[model samples]
Target chain A: MKVYRLRIAVQAISFIILIYGGLFYIDMGNRMPTFSCAYVDDRGGGCFLIGFQHMLSRPFGEFLGDAGIRLLKAMGIFALWSIVLNKAWCGWICPFGFLQDMLSKIRSFFDVDLSRFGWITRTRYKSVKYIFLVLLILIPLGIANSFFGLEKIPRDWSVPFCQICPARVILPVFNGDFSQIHIDFSSNTTMVLTTIVMVLVALFFTTAFVKRRFFCSYCPMLALLSLFDKIGLLSLKKNGQRCTRCGNCSRACPMEIREIEEEKVLTNLVTQDCTLCLRCVEVCPEDKALETRFCGIPIFTASQQGFLKRQGLDEESHTNKNGA
Target chain B: MIKTVISCFMALFCLFPALATAKAAQPATFMWLEPMSWDAIRAQRAKKKAAITKVTGGQQEAPNPAESYSTSQDKGKKRAARGARPRSYYLHSGEFPQPDRQQSGRPARMNGQYNHRAKPKKSQTQAILWVKYPDNRSLSFAPKQRGPVSLFSFPAGDGGWYDLFAYHDQGVNNDSRIHRYSYTHFMSHGDSVDKHETNGIEGPGFFKGQPILEIKRLCADDHECYRTHAGQNLRVQVSFKGEPLANQTLTLITEQGWKQSKRTDDHGKVSFLLIKELFPEKIDRRKSENYLLTTEHVLPATGVLNGQPFHHEHHIATLPLQVFPPKSDWQSKRMAYMVGSGTFLLAGGAIAIRRKRQRKAL
Candidate 1:
């Protein structure tokens, strides 16, 4: 079976559900681990980051009571959802990710060549998402509580990430709500945050033409989902002794991850940046070299015949034709 | 004889001025409900104490309501110590109307203090009903005897608009009168709660029996209808016994005592553009200002009530709404368009140039 075909179908279905499912009264709750923006008036589910930021915006002392319990419960629910499907939430469910994929498809359809980041640049940019994750946690806490005798951060900084997220401005447009496009001149903080949002939104459009899944590299959700990679139920596995290391998997990777081809000894191939798209498994030519596992059961595996069949160069058909 | 006539004329002129002043000082006779936040009440009490201190040459201090309401119980002392504001609203009469702002352009004097912990009157125990929207369930409050200013608290289990209706019917002399006061409060729990559950429902007929005269803000499927902002065209409908009350005078009173009067059309609907009185600098965005909308209807009827014949029945309805500062006061959509378009163009141009250079390098 072609994994890419199945993935595209799944992504399309997930996009419709996340974007327009509220009209059908399908509420998946607000603890989703994907970028289903809450700003959309009829959203089926909501991203957890906004609620997490709001929950963090309380006095540190208040966390000892019901506030602490509430935060724990929310985090637990978010973590459970993250662990079930792993990073499939990114490649298979996130509406923002689906949007980026569609843009990349459009660029490809126009025969536009994709650009590649330099090796040094790619390695250096790996920590960007972790930095964003850390700041997302710290900024809301600072807004509510004074740190080291300093004054509390201004109220304008509440939900700081949401104000700067490109999805907050882009996702609502699909629902015919353009109200989020305005800049709030209420305070200095709001002005700065909203300006950043505008710049990021603009960059989101331009960068998608040059790179595939550009924003996912800097997404704080990816960094969060990476924390549960070890305990996740689904995983990608590699066989070191499978003999040949063809670079087709690495060449076809959307995220430009090279460890899938380079790492020979690591049995678990689910790296921090690996979205578990199964592109690597589909492109691997050697038999039993790469496979995706769900709770110790192999769902799909790499084989020479399957790879050749997908490429329309099946040896069985060629042999039969030659014999005839 | 000329000097005596001049002196009498001067005395008569002085008496005329006194009579005019007396006429102007007549108190407001309407009974309306006012919803005050705990923070506003505290600030008012502090201001009153400061005024009292200045008047008495710093020789005396006024008693604080917080102190007066505190009990000898440890729990009560702890609550007072925490300075926890009441979650409920206060009802007050217009006799001593507390204008949000004085005629001299001073800040609003929220001087009409109502003890939120005080109970409702025993005679009018069933007069007030708290109606929750979407489900539209009318909940009854436990009765207790208290002062004229009553405290109203409801169990806001869900997030939506909770309408508190205070209905009273009394016989005065040879006529009967009905007074209905309604106040809607929006309770926001979080994003999880469905705030638009009450959007499809219309008018003030959510309950089983409608009031004799009712005034309801007309909002057609707007999710933000729970909040009324300045500079927005506010349309209100007045109905008498489930039908439109046409040609009725509806008066809108602002926090600063600015009143605008308009007559309802044949459809019993009146629209008014709420003036932008609170500017960005002077307004606290976290707090909302209260605006009172009132309309009265007089029906000619002859009825015997309490062994008295009534010639006319008067029905007065007041609806208090919380209005936020106008969006235009702080948000600039034009500036946003400029910044957003500029960023998009600049970024797109830069990306195009870089792609061209890369193509050349290849």
Candidate 2:
């Protein structure tokens, strides 16, 4: 089977497992891992990363004291996942990422060719995820400080990033649950916060349908995953000396990550932004030009003949094109 | 290779926090607080059987609270230890104290020698009842000195649980120090008393009318706080029949480790205003948001409690704070559901139309 087909099957299965894994009727003695979406604000009940973010957002004193242990446990759990899958969690496992991919597929089916942002624009947009990560941590710190008799910070500011997460709005819709899209009229703070959430939810739907993986560019989880991307087992490798600068890899990249096109290093070709989707490796036309590896063992390498075969063109058609 | 080694080391180092903070397990105590009848026992068994069959389908194991706290290895030890102890036949169910309405007549000046200003040389005092409700509302009273025991009635079928804590001094017997004892009773409204709801079990030592340190949240005018909002300034009073003597310090500690202390007034009441600020974020709220409020006061002067003489040292009580359902608006819930669904459908349709138009143009 083709790599894309395999990826699609994996994505479908992963999405099902992530979302509906809670539906099983298990006995009290037995238990299952609560593997919900990280971007979702499940009030720290599930999702290791979200729980970590929420814990860090607590007051310094509280966190340094009793909650410190809990924060460490949550962080350790998230770090464990990060070491195992790394950015594969985003490319193949994330329900929200899969949602964006489905939207892009729909866009492609309609023959809609959206313009990729310039390299500079993409580079500037990359920083937004870091900003989101910072705010996700800072807001909780504010709440925690208020808890220490510092100031009466509104409790509604509890999980700030979760209030505006596009997945919070999008993923719930798959189950016919759209309650997250409503503006909470409970308090002034809730009203303002929920209104922002509704607007962002609407904005994400429209943008993601038109522009491929638009929300992933600023996902806090992606930013967090990027921090440990260097230590991940799966990687993308580039042989810059063999490159003809054909730019096929850059064109194939949905994230518009320019580092893969620009990288000179042969070993550490997997940049922070690379999701290890291996689209770059698949599209690289030169022999031994690009490779995907697991633990320094090359799993798949790009070749001119393989690329032609993937595009449904046989050697006969290739020779005819060369003759023309 | 070194980089990878360093990363693995860092990851392992992170695991240390989890290991270091792991709490040591406490010994399991016999926890049946409410009385049970044979009918209640059969009903409980049937309930357990139904739950077990429903869960495991055919598994023989019964649902046990001890299982939730410990591993399967510790389960047998817990069961064995539990079986070894004699089952408690009854709980010291007492009358709810009433508000003071009348003044007590003074003892006819025994030879004008009993110092009114100094600590009583030999007086047998009854235990004090303190009740704390939601909205920071509290009420407390010395059952004997106060005019009458205030009859506080909770909303009988309100579907909320009320925590009834009774603290009395178990007089100094073998030990030189005064031994204080407390009972934490969780009385849920609208539920049959026979229903086996297990909180943590206290040992068999705690019983009726003994010299002990009793501290409790007072429910004002019998208004159960289960129906009020949190963060109200409530008072918690501490007292004992054995006058550990008055004017000594009593320190109150919350579950969050927040501590506040107050000296007992001449009337032997050490009342502290509990300014409820932030909710204990770490603990789960569904099972119980009961803030474990504990107080330990050392006896200042040796005094006689129920004719049993006691010396300095040892008095402590932990009152778990129970809260009522906060007021919420339910009318907006339907509107929220409608708006959310409407936006989802609208967004879906708009995207489909736009995609179709682009396809047509292609």
Candidate 3:
């Protein structure tokens, strides 16, 4: 649990710092300062790879900056993380996911339990999240001069996320100054009121009806991360022998995966949404039954059956000595 | 752990900026020899007319070619024959401005002319140009005939062949009456293939064949940079092909009454440069949008090449272009509104719908 919290905090901070440094630290004019964090200007989504804008032309072809084409390289890095952590980013570090988490919590205050519906609920809902992501990422990509023409889709689509995003609205307010930051709006409407309304409504429903993470099931960012989780590196291991009928871990699991004590596999067998939050591990009294490993290295010191057996033997020795 | 953190932090601080600065360094690598914007040129505080006059000084003057021809004719036939390159530019008046370097952008000349070092020597087959006079000073003069100009050239290697080229003095307005220069001589290389070496034989050039370069004199009336690209003339062309035959220097005599031999391009095409003229508004039924005056080098004769016998026939190509001065009128505004609004609604509406569906799904 300690490891998971520390790692999540580290990743979140690193991501913010990368953007801040790129935007605030440099002042070279006319020179595109390398893969821009100015999500507003997607030279080419692949611009990440090129590092700079190169004016390339042929007898004929579409021309774009390297920004977006650069992000395609992110897939390889994403796959490496998946091999280790699954969709842990979506569940934990993703600011968008985190926003939805806050919303669901607000809902809990209103008594809404979102996780009541099971897999049998409906298959139609599954397509919604993917559809949203395609609209957000791809449609703008296809049009030469559509509305998504020049700006980012994230700030506009993730209304709730941006509304409370500390990087944009809150950080400047808290910092007491905003002369350095420059934000270009892609959407036409003001967000402060809209975000308030949505958050309030979310809070009302969260307490009244649905599960805390229900909105996440349809989150585009989670959906993308899930694709990475398919080949993750870190995994949860379960020992079958010492397993009792304790449903404690499963009940505490956030994404509602079934296997806590018995559902162990050689690899990560849960959904890509496994956050590595270790809430299940913390709840399990017999921690020896479950273990966390990275590429087979003991990341979390697990209490195994062998160690417990040794302890039991040591106790017997002590009692005998005392009685004798 | 501290060391590792320090190294990571150092890498973080240094790496991205290094990568960024490295690419930024490239723009500095290639120095821009030419000015990028008009503001830059304007900021140079260059006087338009003075700069242009230097490029054209007395180069286009024909010394009153008609007067010289008249004097020779009256002075007896011997002197008339000596007046070989007489040109009558008195016909062009008020249509163009006085030649000045500042008014018209000047072509960058290394010594005096871009092709002066590349000039070939004299030969019989080569069309040797003799400029009788190099300055013309008439803003408006009426000409009896507005027809094609003749050009001449010779074999490239043996000397005596020179390609004819013309450039308008920059900064000048649409008045083309400025005297135009003409060169009447050059040499010819035996083979048509390989002429890039002809320039005063400058260290054996990389290519071959004397190319017939079509120097189009774009007048300032053009939309892009009428000020920069166009000077006074609308067009100028050079060609040496035909029924009369491209003699030494690929010269041809125009049957449309022009007796001077004209040079033809390697592809047997004629070259011309013209400052596209603003045509009379289309108010009249015959309103010309633009007047593009162009002329094709009509082949005077042809039979066979290398053994294939084939007869050829021809006609002179056009020299004048139709110019439609973009008029700011009610009809134009109406058309813009019709097209612009329709397109905006259709394109924008489709985008909005696609977005709505996507948002709902999300």
Candidate 4:
């Protein structure tokens, strides 16, 4: 079976389980690495970021005792989940990513061409996710403790990222809950955070038409998952000895990661932006040039025959036609 | 003409206090439990500490008024002296004074007073029946007396609603009437247990077949309950011996002394649309105020208790609820929709214009 078809099936099943699983008593726990939003009333699981932010919003002195241990335990669980699937959590499991993929499918059905970021723009935006990850951590800490003689941040800033996350507003709508869409006018901090979410939701809708997986580019989860890239169990390996560098893999990549095609020496092709969607391995025309390995065992390998069959240009059929 | 109207409004405002005072002067016909305010508790603790210090310094301490006041009239006088506030049953989850923090600057004393070794005095007026969650195990105890108020440290085991039933039975009155004052409080600790479990195995019959009359707030579901808000319809049912008592008079009294009375239907349920009684300042928008729902049921059947014959039984059940400020005070859904749609249109328009310009350039 084609990798893209299999990925779609998995994404559909995952989306259903994460979105409507609560109705069937399926609880995947609250520490899921994906964007299974807790704000969704019937969600089977919850994103870990909300709990993480809340745990971090305590005084530094408190962390010296049970608080620090609790933080580590939660982080350990998150790390275990992230390391197992790696960035597959982003491309294959995230409900938000599935929504984007569905929107991209709609865009494709309408024949709307996908846009690409220029080299300079892509390089500049690479740090955006890292900056968001930093702010999500520092803001919660600042809420509980004073920094450099500055007064403590107000409590309204608790769960700072979840307040601005588009999923908090959008996912709840699937369960017929529109309560989160409102702007809280109670305090200035809430007013600003909720307004920012409104704007992001707007961008999330518009950007999907022109670009595939647009929001994935700036997701803080990607920044966090990238830290486990070296130790992840599942990985993409590239053989440098391949004769051809036709750049087909780069063109087929959804995240537009060029490093997969350009790097000849790095056997590990799971770049920071790579979602492990394995589109590159599927499109690679060279035999055994690219492969997806689980614990160093090849699960899927690039082959000329498989590539031609996927492209509907099997050489055996072509030869038979010529002979006829 | 405008000045005359303004003066009329000013005159009415001046008469408001007199009207309130007149209403407060009316004698309370029913007995209800009231939790001591945090300020009152602190003052009582300070007074106790001062008395202990006087004893340690070899000075004679004055006779305590709380200990001396035993009659109902003396209790009324004490309440009037503090302030003419009615005794309304309420469950407070607010912050309590930390004894260690308060006495941190003082020198350490080995006397049992003001120390952890000191035993908590039990209350003679009120007793609490604590019903735990999930398993619904119940334990009855007389709440520890702290000053004029009783305190019970709820052992929040697994963080669900722990129901507390506070009752004081005034034995056979002069008219051979049994007066029972009962109050139910549902206190939640943390977010561990499922709220749906609150409706299971625990309801109006949670008193375990005891012939106790109680008023229970009827919720459509547990998710809609736990805490109530203003503008919400709060339905309460008055039950006696696990059966509904129809036509009972239930009165809802707000913290500001506003009272509304309603009679139960055939189903023994009365619904009250909790109105916003307190228009709090901007900073106090999240503050929740107490509203007491008191129901009185009279049984005509005779009863004998402790060899004393009672012609009838008078049961008064009071349930205090914390009503939050209405959602409309802080949330504007219409404004949110407008802003959200406006942003979507502006973003879509900008993206379309940019695509058109790029196509033209190409």
Candidate 5:
């Protein structure tokens, strides 16, 4: 539970860093030669996006150009983060997710759809994010391609989220240069639309509002992160026999990972997006039925064996040890 | 020769200051002009021909491959024709510069004519002008939008490769005379290898390809002319407006005395602080013979951009005064006479030596 608190604090800090990325954008994208903050002051001040993008395209060929190279570098950075931190970007730092979480908390809105839909809508639509990522990438290339067979210019590899991303489409329109809206017409339209849509969506699919805990249940990003979860550093274990199903863990689950009922204790194999956002362990009133750890190798209250035995569940940490 | 030289010198002297100060009060951006598809242009011509056919009322027949009005046509048919057709000559079909993109409503062809410094074959026909702006100031090349658009206006090309925009003044007048040295001052953004032509993260050369920007006097066709009459220290200045760049150290030296250096002043103006002092060539000849007088600036451009400031090397034309003492002023103009006489004799002696060598070969 203490770890949960710490994770929240860290998440907030990481959120600040993400905002720094934004400030850096407004900080440096304003100048030209496109992506190079190469000509900066002694402090080397500029956007992380621009500076980092410049670094990537360099090792490759010149066709990418310096600006194009920089953008490619930004992509490499994102991919690296996906491998290292898994889906943590979505959990703690995604500005879109941040907005979603804020909306999910409104106590006033309510809606019950008369139109019924199947659960299959779950896994299918989760694939949309990848499609969105692709769309964002291709649009710019397509435009360049039309002008002078500009097919040679590299695509926007970094911020793959920019393409058809509802987040950007819904918010203030920040230009490629990263300058903020003072009188940006696009920003005004997007702001009004996002606000109106947020209000409407909150009134309708209210459950869709939860944080890293909610839409992430089927988030393609989570699907990707889960693959890396095998080597992840955060996990949770439940003590069944000690589990007086007080409904506490279920109430506390941040990502809404199922916490109760089945006599068998199931460790979330897909915890890459877990972000160790430990709301589950904090609410467990059975004097600790659920516990958190690094890779399910206990670091908190007890070992995995003791908890499984108490639950009368027969599972071994063998596979976790195998790491395959 | 003397008359032509003096005329040229006088022209340089008169026009140099005029160019520096002659910018349009409200300058316009350069927009890309490109032609449409061959099919589209052909279709348009066909439509015009049809119009002419109708106006002629079945009189003169229109040619299929297309032809000039000067070629023999049906005169009696023309009399039968009710309306007269203004003469139209179809240009010979040949390769012309085109933009890569499909027609964006703008027709483009490289207008190297105004570019009096570009090489020959450049002005033969039109191609995409590729109006490349080194910075926003170069934005004049684009059509005036309400303001600057986020879009980059470039030529639409074919194949996999794309063409870049640059306007080189093709050197020659309709008379085929060498282009007048345009003392018409305008900033010349020095060319550098493209980013792709360079390495990433890895900085420029180390003892390999020379690092300095050799000051080149753009020839009639952008040829790099070296060693000249105006002295080697070709007073090169890097400036924004009229203000000189003084802070940065810019060195001009031959490989021999590469040690001497000069820095720009507070006004951002740097003068010739070179190791070798330049001596201008002195020459004299008959009044009407044209002379190929020239000059050189062996400069190397280098310096860290302390901030995000921008700069350019503007080769302001110095007065090409040959100091020809008119026949009226003799005694008082002794220095002019002596220098002019010495130059004429030296030139003659050099010519004589070459002739003697040629005679020996025969």
Candidate 6:
């Protein structure tokens, strides 16, 4: 099977095991560990569980204190997961990422071309995820401060990011539940938060259809994972001496990462914005030019033969030559 | 003859004023008797007669049905006297203001002596404050002079419908000097816990009729109310006349768990602070945080609230403390180390990536 096909299979299985596995335990003897993704909870835990849990749990930042230790313990789980899979979690396993890929396939089936951000906006948008990471950390701290009887923050400000996350409103709809879409009129603040959630959910649907992986550019999780990108085992490598300045890698890129085409040297080609989707590697025509590596081992290598086979052109070319 | 006529007219006018004053002094009268068994009422009469004889300088009067039935003993007492004792009732004459009514206007007065604002009734005395388990076992407490005191009788262990008849006639005494104010609250309380649970005790049930006010806690998490942390919003809804009340002030009291006042929005909902830190003095690590949220609507309580002819709506509901595992010292330390080291690694990785690029360029 193709790598993309294999990735879709993995995404489906993980989504089932993580999202719907709880339904199987009805009337069973022993209960299973829910180990629900901390991200599913607004106060952290899903994939990168450390951010809000640390800020919310701490009494004060001090030497050898209880709060300090708890923060460290919370980060350990994410650290372990990050080291093992790195951005492959985004590339091959994330249900949301797979959903975006599926949307792209649907758009292609309708004969619609994907839209790209202009170079000016693309460069600026690359930093958007870092901005989101900062807000993700800061907003929770503000809430922690409010809890400590500090200046009162708006009630809707609680779970500031998740309240507006498209996934919170969109993901449950796949299971035929639209309850998340309604505004919680419990308070003015909740009404405001739910309103924003609805708007973002609408924007997510429209953008994901026209622009591939539009949300990934500013995903806080992606920014968090990028903090370890240099040390991450998975990498995209480039061969500088392969000659032709063909822009195939950049043109084939879904995220429109220009660095793959702009770089003169052959180092750290896996920049922070790369989702490790390996589309660049798949499109690079030169042999031994572009490679996707796992800890320095090339898992996928680009070549003329592989590219032609992927395009379904090799057999057609052979038939044409025989007929002539 | 003219002097005699003037004197007669003045005397008649004075008599007319005297009659009007006497009529104005009479209070609106009503009575509520606890629906006690006949045997319980007879025992109560006997108890009051002994007390009244002591008060009347040992002069005993024949027991009249009105005198015998009017006196009250602790209603919380069971037939065998095994469970919690009933709270005592104090005799007050004027109408008391409802607990939840905002006190910005004229303060609600009970018997003209107590302001429900300055001297709010203790929550320990609000509503049906006790429950009996299916095995007919219950938590026991000594009888007090004030509080919502009730008896819970259970015969079958299958979580059956238990009858709870509660009534209190405040200010009902043989002493004619004080006005008698009385009211009764009734409900049949029991609903099984779930498909699996056989028998258990639950919270107090809702009042059967309107001017019915309910305080329901809408938690932020699906697990439980107390599992939610402080700073997270806990929405409490108040329904009156089967509709969500709009723009009402409710005292978001948790101080008897965490005391902070809040006003309801257009939805008759108020958000309370869910702080995990205990009040400095009340801090006990072993105990979970508990909250008692109460609100009263002071529009003469429905049915008959006489002497205290004005009804004071009092509603108190409790949410078990939403307590999660507290962060320990080691956990905090581990968090600090992870964050510090993670930052270091991130910084170091960026530098390595830069250095590798430089080496390749050279």
Top lDDT model: 1
What fraction of the true interface contacts does model 3 reproduce? 0.00
Alpha carbon deviation, residue B134, candidate 2 (Å): 24
- Stretches > 4 Å off in candidate 5: A1-8, A21-88, A106-161, A169-218, A239-244, A259-265, A268-275, A295-324, B1-362
Which candidate gets the maximum DockQ versus the true structure? 1
lDDT of 4 by residue, B147-226 (tens): 43444433333335555565556557654554444455554422244444233233332455342777877887555576
Better by DockQ, candidate 4 or 2: 4
> Could you give the CAPRI-style class of model 2?
incorrect
Ranking by TM-score: 1, 4, 2, 6, 5, 3
Candidate 2 residue-pair clash tally: 23
What lDDT tens digits, residue by residue, belong to model 2 across residues B1-362?
99999999999899878766653432111111122333544586579889889888966655432322221222433443221111111222121110111112322221332233453232233443433332122233333332212222221111134344444454564333434344444433211122333322232223233225555445552333443234444554556653433675655443233557677667555555554533433222222222334455664567675576766656555544543223222114455445555676787677668768968999
Fnat per model, in the order shown: 0.51, 0.10, 0.00, 0.59, 0.00, 0.00
Q: What TM-score does chain A of model 2 get?
A: 0.88
**C-alpha DockQ of every model:** 0.40, 0.05, 0.00, 0.35, 0.00, 0.02
lDDT of 4 at B266: 94
Off by over 4 Å in 6: A24-45, A49-64, A146-152, A184-189, A315-324, B1-362
lDDT, residue A40, model 1: 84
Which 10 residues in a row give candidate 3 chain B its minimum summed lDDT?
B27-36
lDDT of 3 by residue, B10-52 (tens): 9988899988886565210000001122343334324544555
Q: Is candidate 3 or candidate 4 better by TM-score?
A: 4
lDDT-wise, the better of 1 and 2 is 1
- What digit string (tens of lDDT, one per residue) describes model 5 on residues B1-362? 99999999999999988877654222211112122323545586679778878999758655422222222233432232122211111111111111121222333333332333333231332211122122211111222222211122221111122212212121232222111111111122111113234221111211122111111123331111211222223344443223444554543322111223555557544434222212212222111111111121222333323232223222211111111212221112333234334544554455457657867999
iRMS of each prediction in angstroms? 4.5, 10.1, 23.6, 10.8, 38.2, 21.9
lDDT of 6 at A191: 57
Candidate 1: which pairs clash? Answer: B100-B108
* lDDT of the structure predicted as candidate 5: 0.34
